[model samples]
Target: MLQRCKTLIVAIIALIFSQQALADTAWDSYKSRFLMPDGRIVDTGNKSVSHTEGQGFAMMMAVANDDRASFEKMWNWTRKTLQNPENGLFYWRYNPVEAQPITDKNNATDGDTFIAWALLKAGNKWQNPDYLKESDAIAKALVAHNVVRFAGLQVMLPGAKGFNLNSYVNLNPSYFIFPAWQDFADRSHLTVWRDLINDGQKLLGKMHFGNPQLPSDWVSLYSDGRTVPAKQWPARFSYDAIRVPLYVYWFNHNSPELQAYKTWWGRYPRDKTPAWVNVTTGDTASYMMDGGLLAVRDLVLQPANVAAPQITAQEDYYSASLKMLVALAAR
Candidate 1:
């Protein structure tokens, strides 16, 4: 009877492992393709460069997949390679082909927030105080360096520099990173995060442009609080603004901010949806959105149809990351 009971326990454990394996199919594919042995995630679509955003995205996915080992690998590499000793924030990109991989020392605020949020989450889930401690340090630096007041509205800049021109500021709508802000507010008990959430939503609500009413990829706000499509950029609702709705819906599904995205996306069928649009001139991408963008569109429009996500073998790093993010949001 003792042997039989032991055998039954072993069988149950095996069954549990098998079930978990079945559910982690997408993560497995993503890791096999993009994740290098050194824990750097490659941007296959962008000449195999690694960035803080990709590192944060993978770390978050590792936590979601319940893979602590993978998360540690990514965190270790990111901290070693990208982190700037002067500040807790990471440099934006690493080009392996360049003599100095870190060509840009400027920090991307979204990546910093996501990394902190992932660390906070991993620390909570795994009951490790070390991860939590590091997360706090990073979070403090992020709040100190990136979060700032522009035009009487508390807004986050695209990076640490060049974005704040004293009299005006450039904001990337995608960088608002609503879910991370919410998590920071809950965990750190910081009023600034809460304030950011409220103010960010309001600012984004006023950013829509053109007849279709879409936000541009990059927007500019003057000291007087007036907004326009950044003169320096192409003034299109392209890659950057594509993530705005994803973050917003993840933070609050019923957000009025999603209305513009929903309206614009609703005009096209799932397969025919354009990759981007010129919010000012009404021009649109001749090519359609990739699998990841489609996944976001589906989630934004039809929240109830939460099907399991799959990663195609040919899917690029960014698209796969987006699809995985949508799957997490769906859950």
Candidate 2:
């Protein structure tokens, strides 16, 4: 009887593992179709390239999946092709065909930083120093050259020389480079993490895009503490906004602020999935990949015993997120 019980337990464990393995492959395949040779995943059916957020989010998935080869190829392509000398930043728009930067004028500072962060993570995982060093260089460049002064907030400008500062100061910019700032906090022993959080919070507060739905993006800041609302160009609340909530929870835990943010999200039914929502209204908008990624993070990292629902929305596209969730859950 004892031997039979042990065999049953082992079989159950094997069954569960097999199911998870198959599920992971399905998700990986769904995302892999969008991936480009140079690591840029183009819009479906259209050859036009997208920005770093999706690319970064996908890379996060790669990290989650422990796909070292995929991670390496993407990171290498991003660094070699995207590095910009003029602003010491990473160019935002790239040509899909040749995988070359489209506009020297539009550098995506956040994407650059995020890629550097992913590379650093990969380096650390594999015990390689070169990737770490490369990450460090990009971090320095983002801080040194791409920052713009606006409305009393120090903001990341859109591109290097001659780019429009007035257009870049919105909330979306904060999300782009913040991951790198958070990642660097432990290594450099600097308050870059706190600084970014505080600065972003300050900007978030100022936007008065209140209600915790967070703006998709924002405009550049000026010398004085005033903002020019990019209402039309708002970054659109989606997965990016979830970072603010996640950040608050990570640092503040179950504090009122974190609860408030979570409650704000709770107002929406999980069944009514949309890509974007107005920060104030919570109305449904088209869905995007970031929304799915953010959902995974929120579900896995919710304060212990918190009553938030576990998101199982897009199982395949979000497989990387699922792996991450499992890892965190195990921890």
Candidate 3:
């Protein structure tokens, strides 16, 4: 009888654990803390106004919850902050209240690209001309500024300026090329799609290196398409680079290269390791929340051509990750 009772208790305990795992308690906590007073999705720094990424994520969440106010707040904020008339490209960062660029240089084309994507969705959902127009302008700027053709790789760079063929190539910025190109193909019906895919494949092919076999944030490129060592590359992979797989999977679902990459990341997976990961070695280096989300994302879903093994999502990680997942999934 004692043995039987012990077995029953074990079963009950397992059931309880499972229930806790799938519980909505974490979701509730996230909803309360992350969302804004007006029901818009917000970053923790509520004192400052919203950002394009935060607004975009908020829009996704709002759409998920059927929250009209949240959606409007996001859409309005994005349209105002991202659109720039002088350069015809979206500014990378801006103050919410004043709607002015925060920094001198535009950070990455991907920021605008993602904003364009969210805006495009908003346009579709509400049939808004303003959203469509802004999205098109950002797409135009991304293509205009970033495109450069080398012997083998036709890719996008961090900013539109020097056509340095001998410069080192990083998969981090290159990953944005696909998303921007996809958006361009979608909006303008251009013939750049083939070039975009080729560029992506070539870059992905070049990312693999080293004894333990890890990819770096950047790679040295020769005019002859020979990959070389450029010590100028950063040691860590930011949140931006980590999303390479996410973007790739979203665009080319069936690419073998992406599939292989995903499998590779899955093999040596460590989602909770550190905020900043070494792009070259896949080593955990630093710890910041923004970069932390990138690793956390791999646990839930990865892009094509990147591999990441799933790990037990910790309580804190799960709470943070699930909220982002919910936001993204809702879109």
Candidate 4:
């Protein structure tokens, strides 16, 4: 019995090491494909532009892979290039081809949250105080600029501005980012993070629409606690809302919020699952999801089936990034 127990322990250790090795190889491949020499991570599918979302994702990836040098390189470039002088928060997008790349000064709340969350993880993992300080600053600025009271709920706007109206506020349900909110609450002991997490989850449970009864990419919350898909955008659960499940699953594997997605995705064949479904009209994406969405689906339904992050031929930036994210959360 003792010998058999020893053999089982050794096998478990070997499996862990093997999984990490696979992850490291995937990280290297991601760096080669998208990370620029100067630390900018290009969105290869979108005019080769860079954005805070990609940078944050890469920073988290670096920390997960234990690539300290890459993390610092990316952080330095991001600070120098994207940080707004008037505010500590980061600007959203950067287009290299534009003569004036940083024309838009709007701060994306999701990007800010991701950066702060990744920095916190890096700080704790690597015992770096500077990262922690900067992370707190970003989180503070994020709360100052975007977090707001709406419809009797503490919700985060999709950006620093342009979403708040007199009677209603626009929200991206995908930006709930539950796991990161939990980290912030744990690290800072801020009741605001806790409030956001609780209210955000409840809001999500109420935002389902159309025949599919899935949350849309964007929703409008009125003063009376009414929620509906925002009219300005397509009323479909597409690129952005897809991550809702990924983040929720990260926070709670047994969360009831995942049932709608599970039911919807389960109705379609694996390859034939449409990328988005209009919650109002029951419309669906013309084409199926890329490898990333599939990875997210498996992560929600069967984590054991999620493959390691690999660059599928012709996969775009968002697809590749989400695939990496799923792998990170699975481990």
**Local distance difference test, each candidate:** 0.89, 0.55, 0.53, 0.91
Q: How do the residues 1-331 of candidate 1 rate in per-residue lDDT, one tens digit apiece? A: 9999999999999987765675598899999999999999999999999999999999999999889999999999999999999987999899999999987899998888889989999999999999999999998998888889877788888788899888889899899998898888888898988889988988888898887687898999899988899999998988877788899889888988888888989999888999989988898889998788888899899988845667898899989999888887877
lDDT of 4 by residue, 83-107 (tens): 9988899889999998999989998
lDDT for 104 in candidate 4 is: 91
Q: State how far residue 208 of model 2 sits from its true place (Å).
A: 4.4
In the range 25-53, model 3's lDDT, one tens digit per residue, is 43345455555555434444444444445
Cα miss at 170, model 2 (Å)?
Answer: 3.7
| TM-score for each candidate, following the candidate numbering | 0.93, 0.70, 0.65, 0.96
| Top-TM-score structure, candidate number | 4
25-105: candidate 2 lDDT, tens digit per residue: 644653555566667655442355666644555665576567777777666666566656655566665666664546544
Error of 4 at 213 (Å): 0.9
Cα displacement (angstroms), candidate 2, residue 91, comes to: 1.5
Better of 3 and 4 by lDDT: 4
Error of 3 at 21 (Å): 16
Relative to the unseen true structure, what is the C-alpha lDDT of residue 152 in candidate 2, on a scale of 0 to 100? Answer: 51
* Model 4 TM-score (2 dp): 0.96
Compared with the true structure, the alpha-carbon lDDT of candidate 1 equals 0.89
Clashing pairs in 1: none
